[model samples]
Target chain A: MTTSKQSAPISFERERPAGKSAARYILGRRLSRVWLYTLLIVTGLAFGLPFFWTISSSLKSITEIYIFPPTMWPAEIRWKNYADVFTIAPFARFIWNTVIVTLLAMLGQILSAAVVAFGFTRFRFPGRESLFVLVLSTIMLPWQVTIVPQFLLFRYLGWINTYWPLIIPSYFGGGAFYIFLLRQFFLTIPKDLDEAAKLDGASNFRIFWNIVLPLSKAALATVAIFSFIGHWNEFFAPLIYLNSTDKFTISIGLRYFVSNPFESDEPREAILMAASLITALPVLILFFVAQKYFVQGIVTTGLKG
Target chain B: MAAATGRSWWHSSAQRREALEGYLWISPWVIGFLLFALGPMIASLYLSFTEYKIGGSPVWLGLENYIRAFSQDKLFWPSLNRTAYFAIATVGLGTVGSLLAAILLNQNARGRNFFRALYYLPSLTPVVALAILWQWLLQPQVGFVNYALYQMGIDGPGWLTSRQWAVPSLILISLWAGIGGGRMIIFLAGLQGVPQELYESAELDGASTLQRFFNITLPMISPVILFNVILGVIGSFSVFALAYVATDGGPNYATYFFVLHLYYNAFSYFQMGYASALAWVFFLIIFILSFVQIKFSDRWVYYEFS
Candidate 1:
């Protein structure tokens, strides 16, 4: 990656024509550079404008939002709209519920995925490859295939309308994708560490806990962050399992705000935008802070067969 | 071979211990797979043949649900068609758009990271927020999109409100949010893996920029392209959140996707058995599509390192 980056500018420089008049060549090159930047900046704005619109609209007054020739900046920024979001619904409770579910899910998903990945990477056991392939195959199976039966299973277990339905699955395996990711990361770790740990009288579980995990922080962080975002953004399961408004995740709560008839009459677009922003802020912030891990995870998954 | 003793490997106690430990370590996933994945799969297959409502005992229907879906269900085929349309449009547009953006970003330009981050910001936004944001942006009257169109002397059609434009509008919104996203990052990584010497040699041989890209850059990154396409297919087919929040498969069912149909049957109508049938059909479709993709990918996907 570094080699490609370094060579890129040199290649561009080398592509210059030697026979061209100096001033003309410089002028053409400058124009092309300007063109390139202009194009990039335009593309950037197209991608970035929606986020800008989201944040800008969240602070606008309802009437102002409806104004023709819509203003990019709110004429009078209403920070109180953020506060009003909570009053409009039990958004605070939704956030708390989401936080609880997300945290527990993330913990279970990372730990279970790591353990499962460890088993796959460290042991030359019977049927290991076949089991791993089975796990990978699950990634392609649409969630709908199992959703109905899973719903029934959970209902029969008396876990409907509870966070248990959302959280318990994470403790089992989290997901095949996460397990595959951690397994890839685990394979990169040298087997000598396990041997050394064994020589020190550490059990396989102890070596996995102490040696393998400690060295795989970046991969673990990737799993943790992905799990966090996934659980936080999950809608269908929470919608199906939890019937009570108080137990609603933020995603469902935001949907309720949009469709709730009592609040429909009011011009609540600004507040709705505000609520959306709040719902998305945590993941957005995490992306900025842990952008490296996010990129690494994607790259690893893409490059690996 | 050296480690293999003059005895059968199965007879070794060490190997047995390792196998036991391995199973123990992976027991969580195995248990989960049975309880969650395989168990549900088998249960759904059985349920698909019955007439199970939420609270009632399942009555054996024996292909009634499948027959109803194939012969009678009004929304089933249309929803499947709509989902296919959505998948094709998004996957097609997303792949080309992201690849182009990646190629551009791969250029040795200033403020690359800043631009990368800027473009990536939308992807990090929750789908609920993205749907809401797009809803406002695509509003026929007061929306920014129409407003901008009007500014340019073009009348924007009713987006979410119009049956004609609803699916297309959702596709456009998805492209806007996703083109600069993780897919783009994956493409960027792929772009990086293309050895610069290939380009240099091509240039030395008087290859045009276009020729070099087609001949060198694309072939080098074909494997990544294949990966993204597969993922894109799976994702677009399963798209739920945006449609659920933004349109609720509305505008005269223009956006009624396959999953939404299944969701309605399973949850709203309490036709668990029928929904299970729908799910199994969906699974088969996806499976075939994915299998076909993998089968055909060999023609285009070039794994340079492998």
Candidate 2:
């Protein structure tokens, strides 16, 4: 919605600030524009420079990395650092683990959230509003409150050191936030469609499957993109559950990379940067590719709340 | 909209079936809620009052762990104080920064989207990646941040290394990565919702820009601001991975916040009872903070519908 969001700044040609006042208004606007750019450029660089450093440093030669007043551009791009990242540890396996958890969790979260949201939006029953309130309340409930018992529960189930702990809970309900998001989206879909489908003797599940799910693709994609970034970046749970190195996700794998049995020597900072870049690359690509969905997710939740 | 049946009362078998179907459709979430959320919460509450370090049944400790947290644990009060300080700095600066950035980005122009994307880039980076990257960037001797400071004849502090700057450094990292993301977008949405006509009217009334901002923009978006601050406080309070990685609550425990204390107690020291008590305290603080904010927000928060 922020795309070309505002109409041309309330063009009130009538009774506008006149004469020197108009010029002063224009001059004030110009002065503020100058200030805006000054702040924007400074902060833009503040945000962008670290990313630039990380990206450039990832490709830098080890010597270039240590150079005083680090070079903005690498003198020689060393693709070797990227390759060396794989040899140093089970980096590929870590990526594979992260991908598996993210994919499975996304699938679970999307399907279950869609189902729950449909139930909440399409069907009305006794205490429905109260039940929905309960669902919404969980959004404010911090994961920390439930994390210990959850860890103990998982450990007791012998699900520790496996992907089960990471992926299983997602199937039950994606989360309260996603449920709320999709519920909002679902409420906007005309109930006449469901009624039309039902008039044809369609089952509730049939209408949900054939009519609602297809129409909700955009909302679902928003959830999916958020899911990908969230799961990819998730560090806390994986840190607790997957203690074995061979089973580690990229987040923790990189954490303990220095002591990898595969590499006796400490890896170069460039190589580590390269590894970090690799870990962060997929989400970045997804962001640029699906920037609309990601930003829409933010705007939707922000304004709707 | 009650249902397709359009019946609030289940007088007919069809209405009954609709009710059953609704329940059936929502059953999975209900099960999950019970198993994961409600069950665990109740268990943790019970565990907080009992000592259980796994491998043995919980010995009923009544209020010992709670008492210990208040009076015994050396790090508990200090860590909480540290966390409160961290929350104030990060949330305060972050909300203001995001609001300012949103105001700036709201202008209609070319390259606005580019700048918005630039601003959002850090938030997309994984928290672990951010921690490590900042660690490298703030390296006392070789860091580029210090190098820049040197150009200005200002000696940059040790940052994550110095006890004095550890919390500040963590706050800086959090702000750098977070200030431009969702909260900014929220503020942008809020700003967009403030009718352009209001500004046009204010302009005709001869209100200065500062006057318009104070009287119009601020009041219009106060609800969003309140929501962001509440979320920001909750987020900053429980933040773990950044500190866990950047400093490990370190450089002499200056960056050790409340959650890390709970984490170490439960996971590292196996003080499950104590950790649960800490967690309950954390939950209650968040609950009360949210409650108080909502209760008092009526004084300042303007709701359009109401």
Candidate 3:
């Protein structure tokens, strides 16, 4: 799409004679710039304010939260609400369950996705191209299409109310998008390294394990981070499979807090808000720490295709 | 080079070894496909044509579930309509909003990354949290949204409780959560891919900004736009978690999404056969929509390659 033309730079601020039209043109451009910044700031606030409100409300006293002409900042900060969240529900167990499921699922997703991606990238076997296409097409298949039968399959295996349904699927290949992403990253590595390893009597598996895995750490990190965030925030599968409150993940546990029968008349909005913030805090922290990988993963997968 | 020394394709030990290793490497995914994806797909298809509850054996009932869905089920058609409406609104407004946000973010302005991060933070929050946050934000009396409207001398409608505003409220929550997310990132990438020289050349040609955008920018980003639209359609059609947590598909079933209906049938009511039928029908609709999009994308989606 690049052009071979060489053009002189044009400036919107080029000097003009003192005339009505020129003055109007300059004023219009300046006003438009102002409008653009205004729009940006307004949009930014619209997105940012909810988060601010969420955190603020989490600290407000019960009566303060319902006062007319609601204050943006809590009148008196209730630091105990954070601790009260634990007493209100078995949040500690819920968090423990969430961490366990997330870690196992992340491990399963990264390992299986890396191995599958290596196969697609390194091997020149027959039907490889068509098989890759099959993998890509799975990205488009909605989860609802498989939910019923998969649930039945899990039920038949007597795996209900366990973490098996949530964790085991990741080992089967995590997701199509992750595999596609890793394959793209793998294709960029020089074949000379693999050839040298082979000449030194290294097997395909050894080359993959020793050389390829080390080189693709960034891509694998991206995969792991995405998998971590996904499983951490996952609500549907846990809702469907795990029946008891003892097995509830944080997502389901938060729902249980919202629907707690004892808190119906005197709903603990502050505690619920505190619990919500706690549930969402890890992902926010992860995003700030690994912002680049999140952007790279989305852009590369979405645009390169 | 290896192929040049081959005597015959079938007799080459190297090729045979490569094929075996390839299968071994991909065995996990292959096994996963059989057990998780393909197996369920076939089983679901069969289940759609039978009467199968959680504990009971399958009984053959040909076309009955499908017929009941079309002609008998009270919630089926309305739920489908609501889902379609939700999809159209979300995909339509979301694509435009994210595109605009991306273009703004792409500007050579100060604090661009800060602005982008602020916009993207909501997406990182879980849907359950978002639903809770929005439920409070949209509360008619004590909520921020209505409170602001009241200050301006215009009372805000009951967002989640009113039938007229319930779906729109859900859409608003979705937009708030998603507009600054992956779609914006994709559009930003697309925007960056457009050659800078094209704009300079257009300026020299005395092309108006509007004309330049229409002729150059739109065509360049059409493929990204198309990708986002199709994904948006699929995603909005499967709207469940927000509605489940926020509204519970209530306010007179105004936001009773397709998946929520299916979920209720399969889990709450234990009508596995009917839920499977619903799933197949939903799948067919999405499949056709996607197929048609691909067919028509040839007209608008620009590829730099041939």
Candidate 4:
């Protein structure tokens, strides 16, 4: 523990000027920053090529999708494909259902995980450490192990083909990874803050409510973003639990374009691409908004393990 | 307000009362775990010993399901072997690729943030969509992947159809999608944790980039690597959606992973008891793998903050 801190300062001094010189050397030794930028731009294009291809193809007719040499751009952006996508199945309803489930699950995950994390980090109880480890252990238990029993259990409860099976678990802390993440973050805060609250005559609940909650905004935001993205992309649970077209999440509903064994008569490729891009839009938006906190949480949580 | 001074009305409550309140606060998780997790887990163990379909009560027939899976089922051992192969390949390729990308990204290169986001984008794509995209891209005749290979004068095999190549194709696609998700993120974090002074000392000592990486960077981030490996093993074995969406575990059942087999048994074959046996076996395999990793991790994983 002491070794890392002691060595850290020494290394900082030793590396400081050498790093500056190396940076200067790389810059001065380069062909051109423009060329470096060009390489970056090309790599960026390669990385983003799929998204562009998907979008451009979504705006094209089937003939254009298979056109020889592949059209890099669409001649005419077919807006009607969007309408056709919905007509093929209840695309609108799928979108609506996906949004509903994602929001509900995200909210449930954040609230439940945070409360449990708070209990683990702030409270002194006999089984707190043991319970925390149990939570962590669940992260390793493959969902496959639980799938059969869960299926039967759901069936016995008459919960099959309903959103209840999929959405209810989040409220009960179904995913343990997020709970572990929040617990580590909560532990990082100084204990004196809690002691100060106690000195001010604050009870444990009020201290947690007023002080801990406000202090953990970043961790909370990170949890919210992760939960939203996960639930948004989830397909398997919805596939198993929702039997009706009306209850289908967007992920499952998008499968309608492909008739399982073959492509449907409609614009399957275009419509599928459209649906994929549409589903990815919310996550992309959330990523941009919470980029800093998300990255921080990932790094810190990694260290905790 | 007087609680801090040990004078509040509620503060005088007996120790038993406080303990009761603690249980009350945690009651939701306790109830939920017993109902959803503990009950199902225990019931699945029992079901594995019996024979039950989805409709009827299980009839106790100890060891039959397990024995049948081991001796009679051709698909069981093959699926397990194939899954292990795929896990090794996926984790190997995914770790190397993501580690490279993360190392490059960690350099204070301009526009790094943009590239990082771009790299992470595909990981966020729904597995179904990504599978469909890969299906199109890997189609032997119509796929862009084969098309590219064709130009190189190498005819691509039927990626999704050929039993010989189907598992590899699934592994490659999954590796590509999963690379930036956990590995890249964690590796980037590990890079940050490595003190800059170590690099400077290595450079001062005339350690080349490769030497520095092997000696310093690897040791520093071994914990993260270990963590990613554990996650990868668990994830690779439980693969469902990708194979489900991509090949439907077919072209000869070559790509049928363990979970898919379990799904087919319970849902399609209507052999709930048999599926429960398979699930327990799969869980035990994962548990053993993770336990071994944790056991070995202490030898190599460096904890900077400890």
The DockQ scores of all candidates, in the order shown, are 0.43, 0.40, 0.40, 0.35
Candidate 2 TM-score, C-alpha based: 0.93
lDDT tens digits, residue span A159-203, model 3: 999999999999997799999889888988999999999899998
**Candidate 1: CAPRI quality band:** acceptable
**Model 2: CAPRI class:** acceptable
List where candidate 3 sits over 4 angstroms from the true fold.
A1-31, B1-10
- Ten-residue stretch with the least lDDT total in model 2 chain A: A7-16
Q: DockQ: which candidate is best?
A: 1
Off by over 4 Å in 2: A1-32, A258-267, B1-8
Candidate 4: residue A106 lDDT (0-100): 88
Provide i-RMS per model in Å.
5.8, 4.8, 5.9, 4.9
lDDT (10s digit) by residue, model 1, range A131-200: 8889988887888899999999899999999999999999998798899888877877889988988998
Question: Candidate 3 docking category?
Answer: acceptable
- Best by the TM-score measure: 3
Which ten residues in a row are the worst by lDDT in model 1 chain A?
Answer: A1-10
Clashes of each: 0, 0, 0, 1
lDDT of 2 by residue, A231-261 (tens): 9999999988988888999999888763344
Residues A1-305, candidate 4: write the lDDT tens digits: 01222211111112323334333222232335566567567756656776777788779887777765566678988877778777767778988888888889888888888777777776555565667677776777677777788887788789988888878888986367777777766777888999998999998888778988788887788788888889988987887778887788888877755644334454367766776777677787888787776676666555565
